[model samples]
Structure formats: structure tokens, C-alpha cells
Target: LLLDIVRLKGSHSAEHIRNTTEQILDHLSINDKVYKIITDNGSSMIKAYKFGLSVSDQNFEDEEANDEDSMDVDEQIGY
Candidate 1:
């Protein structure tokens, strides 16, 4: 069982969610490749990601995302 916990402030839109998720995935890929990633019931994240939730598969995998290195500019400025 592997999981990457993402702490998001307030809420997000679908486009915003995709952008954020992509950033995390890109960072994670630097260390190790992942078969899939998962997130909770947040509307934006859930709708934007293809591999959201459902960790019942045999191929479930995880890799830590270096969020500190690639922070979201919009989020930092309160967008």
C-alpha cells in the first residue's frame, strides 16, 4: 500500500487541479515511475485526473512528489 498525501488549500477548479497534479507527477517521476496515482473526493482533482482514487489493483504504486522544488506559483499568490 503506497500513497502520496497532497495538502491543498481551500478548493480548486478542474483546470487548476490538472495543472497541480501534473506538477506533482512530474516531480515524482524524477525519482521513480508510477503505474498510477490517487487522490480523494475533491471535485476538481477527482474530475481532472484519470488515475484518481481506486487502489485495489495489483499494479498500485507510489512515488514521492518533490513539491518544495516545484511549487505552484498561482497558489502562492492566492490564485
Candidate 2:
């Protein structure tokens, strides 16, 4: 996923966030599957909730468990 942020002096941050979120949701809802998502470290985006989808924290866990089933089972053990 690509996040395009336009610098507009007068626009509200919430408006931009809302528009972007809606656009992303619309596109993703129609597509086959949403594998992963990327967003900047902004206040609005940081609070994004994971609804049982695969989310990458950009840190490699291990080499052996790359698949979802292994990752899910291993994540609990790690915690």
C-alpha cells in the first residue's frame, strides 16, 4: 500500500486521513486480499487496529517460520 501525503496549508489533518482511509478501504474491499499494509508513524495511522489480518512490524522474527500457520503458533510462544 502506498500513502500519498500532499502538503496543503489550509487543510485539516483529519480530513486528509479520512479521505485516505476511505480510499484505501474501498480499493482493498474490492481486491482479492489485503496481504499487508504500510503507513507512516503518524498519530492518526499509528492507532490503526489489526482486525485479524497479517501486519508486518518490519522486524524479521525467524527464518523457519515464514508461513501464517507457523507464525501464528510461534507468536504466542514468543510472547
Candidate 3:
């Protein structure tokens, strides 16, 4: 569903896209309810959702560690 359409007046970099998406989710109070986001194969889109939404206060290091752990688990399970 299309909830809102915001008009931005600046460069649409990865940071800008991510910030705008976060703002919209926060404004709707659905940050915790989001599971996945679909976007085109643009570079900015890929970078914006590289770590998913910042639903909590997790730092980049923590996310990297978690990703490593998941990879290990997947490797062990022959995934």
C-alpha cells in the first residue's frame, strides 16, 4: 500500500534515501512492523537497505558481527 508520497529537493544519495525511508516508517509508527523492503537494483537502493532498517540502536559493528555469525551458521548447515 502506498502510505505517503514525499517530495524531496536534494540529491537522492543512499544516505538520503535511507533517511527518508526511516523517517516515513517512523512517522507511521511501523518501524517495528516492517519485515522487508522492495526496491529496484539501483546502487543507492542497494546501499540504503544493505543492513535493513535501523529499528533499534544497534551499531554497524554489531550488525557486522551478527552477519558473520549467521554466515557461520549457514556454512555449518551446508546452506
Candidate 4:
């Protein structure tokens, strides 16, 4: 689900976007729930996920791969 959208009036440099995205993730308390953040093929988005969000595109950065699958199944059944 689309939970939030942050709009800025100033320039959106990579560093700025990274910081903003991190803060938003922290504020929402959904950091662990996030796996992959689908975004446009923009450098800022890629950098935000890599450097700022610190998440890999292919993996969820978690030790247990099954944890995410379990979470997905749980969410599907309204657990």
C-alpha cells in the first residue's frame, strides 16, 4: 500500500534524498517491514536504497531469508 509521500520545494540532491528517506523510514517504524522499495530508474533512488536506506536490491539484508517469506505469508492471511 502507498503509505506516504514526501514532497519538497527545494533541490533534491542524492544526499538530501537519502537523509529524507532514512528519516521517513525511521519515523514510520516500518524499517524492518521494508524489503524492496520500487522506484524509478533514477540514480537518486538507487543511491537512496544503497547508501541511505542501506538495502540491497536483490536481498532484504536480513540474515534469515525465510523470515521475509514467513512475514509475507502471515500478512496475506491477516496474521
Candidate 5:
């Protein structure tokens, strides 16, 4: 069910995506009813749902965190 189609004007960072999703769920009063969220393999989407309540995989989270850290370092050094 497509509740709403929002047009975001600014950055599409992980935090922004998470906040936008939370806001939408809250507005619809269905935050607690959401079991899973399906999104593309984009980094922002992955980060936004990485630690979701329904999903529990410490190893996966650690791996993703390490990957993100390395990417940050690489970006800083102009990789």
C-alpha cells in the first residue's frame, strides 16, 4: 500500500531517510505495525534499516559498520 509519495529536496543521507520513514509511520499511526521495510540496495537505505527491530544479526551489523568505516576512510583519502 502506497501511503504517500514524498518529494525530498535536500540530502538523502541515512539519517534523513530514517527520519523521513519514521515521520511517515508516525503520521499514519502504524509504526508499531510495520514488520519489515523493503528498499533498494542503496547505502542510505541499508543504513536506515540496518538496525531495525525486526531484524537481528550482530555479525551483519558489524560487517556493515566496518564496511562503512572503511568507505569513510577511503573517501577521506580520495580513494
Candidate 6:
């Protein structure tokens, strides 16, 4: 269900739109409640969702590395 709406002025770049959407998601979905987002097929929305929960490319890379590390640990544990 739609819970809230926000209006923005000026140009809406992908990064800007992502920040605003994330802010709303932050207020609405906490403690890992957020899973997926659905939006119009606008290029800006597509790009914004691509950013995921990471604020920077470096953070995304770090997450990838951590995930790989966890997989290695799992393999060692006979999982």
C-alpha cells in the first residue's frame, strides 16, 4: 500500500531521485523490511534502483567482497 508522497522541485537526476526515494523507504521500511521497489519504467527510476542500498560504488564493491567472503566460509563449514 502507498503510505506517503513527496514533491520535489527542480531537475530530478537519478542520484537525486534515488536519495529522495531512499529517504521515504527509510521512514517506511526499517529493520530489513524493505525488499523490492516497483516504479514506472522511467530511465531515472531504473537508474536510481540500480544504486541499491549503497551510497557509493566503493560500498557496493565492499559488499560484494563481503558476500564472497561469507560464501568461502560457508564452503569450509560444509554447507
Error in Å for residue 28 of model 5: 0.5
> What's the lDDT for all of these models?
0.57, 0.52, 0.83, 0.70, 0.81, 0.74
Candidate 4 lDDT, 34-61, residue by residue in tens: 6656778788777766743455554554
- The C-alpha TM-scores of every prediction are 0.39, 0.33, 0.63, 0.55, 0.63, 0.56
| Model 5 lDDT tens row, 1-79 | 7767798769999888888888898899887666567889999999988987343466557768999999999999999
RMSD (CA, Å), each prediction: 14.7, 8.5, 5.7, 7.0, 11.1, 7.1
Misplaced by over 4 Å in model 4 are: 55-79
RMSD of 6: 7.1
Instruction: Supply candidate 2's per-residue lDDT for 3.
Output: 41
Report the alpha-carbon TM-score of model 1 versus the true structure. Answer: 0.39
Over 1-79, each residue of candidate 3 has an lDDT whose tens digit, in order, gives: 7767998769989999989988998899997766568889999999989988755545555667889999999999999
Residue 71 miss distance in model 5 (angstroms): 37
Per-residue lDDT of model 6, residues 1-79, tens digit only: 6757788777778888878877887787651455456889899888888746534556556768999999999999999
lDDT measured at residue 11 in model 6 versus the true structure, 0 to 100: 71
Write model 1 residue lDDT over 1-39, tens digit each, in one string: 453557766667777776666677677763234445566
Candidate 6 off by > 4 Å: 29-31, 54-79
Better of 2 and 3 by TM-score: 3
Better of 1 and 3 by TM-score: 3
Clashes of each: 0, 0, 0, 0, 0, 0
TM-score of 6: 0.56
- The true-versus-predicted C-alpha distance at residue 39 of model 1, in Å, is 1.4
lDDT of 2 by residue, 1-79 (tens): 3544455456546555555555665665732244455667776555543342343443334323477667798898994
